[model samples]
Target: MTQEQVTEFFHQQLGTNACLEAEGYTIDDPPSLDTFIDSYMSGQDIWLAYGSLPVLSQQEWYRIQEVCPQP
Candidate 1:
C-alpha cells in the first residue's frame, strides 16, 4: 500500500482502536509514513504499532468484532 493508503487505513481504525482501548488495552499511535514504509519494505510486521492485546475466546471475540468490525 502507498503511504496515503496506509494512513487512510490507520484513520479508518479509530473506532476499532477506541473499542480495543475500552476493552482495557493500550493502543499506540500509528507510525509515520516513512517509518511505516521502511518497516514494510524491510518485512517487519506492519501491525507492530497496534501492539498486542490479551487473548479472548471465540464468543467474546465475536462480541468485540460486532462493534469494531476489524476494518
Candidate 2:
C-alpha cells in the first residue's frame, strides 16, 4: 500500500489531495501508533519538508502511515 501510495504520490499526481485519494487506513495523528509512524515516515519528506517547523498535510500524513506502518 505504501509503495503504491508513493508511486501515485510521485509519478501519478502532483497535488497533495490527489496523491492521497482512494487509499485506506485512518491516520489522524491521534493514537500513539500514528505518532510513531509519523516520526519514522518523516524521512520521506525530502522535497516538501522544510521550514523551522514543518507542518505536513493530510495526504502526507496518510502517505506516512501507508509507507511506515506501526509494528
Best by lDDT: 1
Tell me the whole-model lDDT of each prediction, alpha carbons only. 0.68, 0.38
Highest TM-score among the candidates is held by which one?
1
Give candidate 2 misplaced runs (Cα > 4 Å).
1-54
Tens-digit lDDT string for candidate 1 (2-64): 767766666666657777888777878666667766776678877542355567788977887
Minimum summed lDDT over a 10-residue window in model 1 is located at 47-56
The alpha-carbon RMSD values of the candidates against the true structure, listed in the order shown, are 2.7, 13.6
Cα misplacement distance, residue 38 of candidate 1 (Å): 3.1
Candidate 1 CA-lDDT value: 0.68
TM-score for each prediction?
Answer: 0.66, 0.23
